[model samples]
Target: MTDSALAPIDALLRTHIAEYPGFPTPGVLFRDITPLLRDAAALRTVIQHWKTLIPEGIEYIVGTEARGFVLGAPLAYEIGAGFIPVRKAGKLPGNPAGLSYDLEYGSARIEIPENSLPAGARTLVVDDLLATGGTAAATLELVRRFDVEVLGATFLIELAGLAGRDQLPGVPLTAVWTIQD
Candidate 1:
């Protein structure tokens, strides 16, 4: 949970990041991570960093849609836990539980396959970034619907100034690198 253990992966993130001002809207600085996703070393570093931060008794890694599946799948593999996809509404093939919430720029809904995780299963939520806590909070709500215990939540990088953590009150949240903006 400390920055000390996160140092090894900092260089990789910095190398692959790009920032754009006023993206998707005015007065918004968009941080793109496609560069990191395209690099083997950077991806490996992300999985490695997450492997060490997983909370004890975590039986599953619940990844938020899109980017979360990108890194969370691999991290779950390395950590010997199962990966549960919390995808966008209508993306999954079966009956799924859904949650709607606001985004940094818009509103959206997310879902998880019904009965994907057993009742009381301990889980850790992972994602590439933490900008607004809405997605993560919604994911946690989905987890609760399945009756899973959230061991903790982890992110590769956190946009710290957004107060994303405040929305997910009482959860043990950790990010490898936090950018205050």
Candidate 2:
């Protein structure tokens, strides 16, 4: 789709994003995107927007496990890039590279297959949201173990006030929306 076609998509996201206060904890407001995902047109717009940012030589898209899968799979197909999952520890079979980090509520580890991509392969990381940057940062570290060149990290939304970008120094980031908390 053309750039002009994406305007409606941006508008749809602003209209549909639902906000919940004290979600999963007190003093925390969550920008719920399920409403936007439920709208077919909005979802298509987001995928198309993401497709435009994928670098030309990207061989793989490393998507964080779970929610990231929702965006990454369709995006992989859209751009003809291979999809690799950065899963929680023990969720993957065979040997994988693991990295540990803390989340808003707890600490955890994420992993990816050691040989998922060839050495020096270019990759793009995708996820639904960027909050504290822990998950994305850990995933980036895991990808580096394979000696791959990370193209960038992309997200549907970024919580600007959380300072997630600070954790991701030197890496490019792209997001459709930015919300200051």
Candidate 3:
């Protein structure tokens, strides 16, 4: 579906997202997006909405490992751009540049191959959610190490009170849905 035709995207997100309170920890409410992924209409709306947020002329779409991979690949195909996967520590086959950061519950690392993209390639980063912004910031740093310009970062949803966007100053970020604390 065309980007403009995705006006119902917000409703689709609300319908399919599952809320799990105290998940992975006490006092933490996790907004699970797996339900949205399972629903064909919600999934399509998410991709289309995010595609609309991406500015034109992006050469590469970089997605963090795991969940990012699922969203980024289709977005890359839809926008006719190249896809680059930023994987976890030691998961990448080649010598990769890695960045370490703290998540809400624990610390984690993300890696990207040194040669994933040519120098100065424009890249758009995609992820399933934006919580504390640690992962997103690390991914951005990893992309910068390759000398690629980060066009923007896109997410299916954002937890507003977490202030994730503060960590990504000067980088464009777009979310189809946001949960206010």
Candidate 4:
């Protein structure tokens, strides 16, 4: 859907996110989606809207560790696609392919289980938030290791002030809501 078409859902989503000032660190504002997840109506609305945003024929949804799992899994089920979980280092069992990257706040590593997808499967990377795009970019890199076709990426919210999109060139990115932070 176009930005204008998604305005209603985006407006409703804004109300679902809780804002915290100076959380997890000083001088950092946190937008929490716990409230969104707790509300059945809101969650359903988001999932339905995402269905329209996601491309047709996506073979799998690659969710980033943690929040992405919450959103991606259901969306995958809704769209009849498989779900792949990308995790932080050491979180995956067995021999997983790993990649290290820098975050806006610090540095971290992400990993995906090796041979998780059949070669040439198409996928969409998903997460709850897009900040500096470090994690998303790293997750995309990890997804590439599987020799799959990355269709695009989607997020629940985007901190536009951070310009995370710049970190992900040549990839179609969609966010349910965008706010300056």
Candidate 5:
């Protein structure tokens, strides 16, 4: 990504990403991106950064549930890729392929639409944040069930020092903003 792309976006993120201490539990600092999402230019810069990182021939963009849906759908559209959803179990209509996994806080499951892609289709997995890699790993496994090759996993933010990337071995992961703990 260009220095022009990184500077402005990182500045906006540093300024607007809210920190909630003792969230979901004590000793936790939650970096909320709601303000970044609300800023059109910052949001655009985020996608623009992804545009530079995303390799060509990505047939589909697979987004993790909740926040990923916010960024992934738009990124897929901007990059001319089909959007595939990876959601929380029981949240999807009809039967889907699901995988249960552990998160930094607790256990959770993620599911993808059955037969979403043909074998070997290049897909990029996306989410808003990577905290412990549980959800991202689960989503990656679910996506592989469809026999597609996951090009990479991308995130809007990465909580450094958590080592979430350890859970996702052999997979390329990119995060636009990184906060060291």
Candidate 6:
């Protein structure tokens, strides 16, 4: 959608997102979308915007562990695609494809369950938020293990100026809201 067309949704999202100062740690501000998730109209609006960004023939939506599941599952259902979770280390049931990456404070790992997406399946990576992109990048790598074609990545919100998009490199990225940090 055009920038002007998205203004109302953008404004709606800005109001729905609650801010918490020094959350999870000191010196960090957190953007919370729980309010948006609770409001059906707001949630539907977000899904609609994201749906428009999706390419045809997306076989699956691979969501990051936790919040991604919240967003991706519905998008997958709406788009008639399967949903796969990129889990944190040891969160999967079987021997899943895994990738280790470095976070701001330490190292971390994410996994995609074995036999999740068939080879050559077209997939989209999705998440609630994109900050530093360490987790998102690792999730992308883990999804690639299935040998599927990644159509693109999408986020409900992107914390701009952190260069999270840099980690994604050549992938097409669409964010419902890009918040300057």
**Tens digits of per-residue lDDT for model 6 on 42-110?**
899889888987788998999987889999999999999999888888987878788889975469888
lDDT of 3 by residue, 34-137 (tens): 89778877688678767877789999999988889988998999999999999999997868889898988889998888788998998999998899899999
Question: Which candidate, 5 or 6, has the higher lDDT?
Answer: 6
Rank ordering of all candidates by lDDT, starting from the highest: 4, 6, 3, 5, 2, 1
Tens digit of per-residue lDDT, candidate 4, span 1-181: 5668878897888789999988867877888889999999989988998888878999999999899999999999999999999988998789999999998677999988888988899999999999889999999988988888999999999899999999999999988788876
Best-to-worst ranking by TM-score: 4, 6, 5, 1, 3, 2
Residue range 56-153, candidate 5, lDDT tens digits: 88989998878889899989999999998888889877888889988777789888777788899999998988988888888888888888888899
Q: What is the alpha-carbon lDDT of model 6 when measured against the actual structure?
A: 0.88
User: TM-score for each prediction?
Assistant: 0.92, 0.90, 0.92, 0.95, 0.93, 0.94
Where does the lowest 10-residue lDDT sum fall in candidate 6? Answer: 103-112
Tens digits of per-residue lDDT, candidate 2, 77-142, equal 899899998898899788888988898878999988877988899899999889999898998888
RMSD of each: 1.6, 2.5, 2.7, 1.4, 1.6, 1.3
Q: Cα miss at 2, model 1 (Å)?
A: 6.5
**Cα lDDT listed for each candidate:** 0.85, 0.85, 0.86, 0.90, 0.85, 0.88
**Model 1 quality (TM-score):** 0.92
Per-model clash counts, in order, read 0, 0, 0, 0, 0, 0
How many angstroms is residue 34 displaced in model 5 relative to the true structure, after the best TM-score fit? 1.0
Error of 3 at 116 (Å): 0.4
Q: Which sections of candidate 3 miss by over 4 Å? A: 1-7
Candidate that beats the other on TM-score, 1 or 3, i.e. the better one = 1
Please identify which of the two predictions, 3 or 5, would achieve the higher lDDT against the true structure: 3
Model 1, 1-181: lDDT tens digits are 4567566677677878788899989988887889988988887877787677768667999998788988899988997899999988889887788988898889999988887999989899998888878888888887888877888899988999998999889999888778987
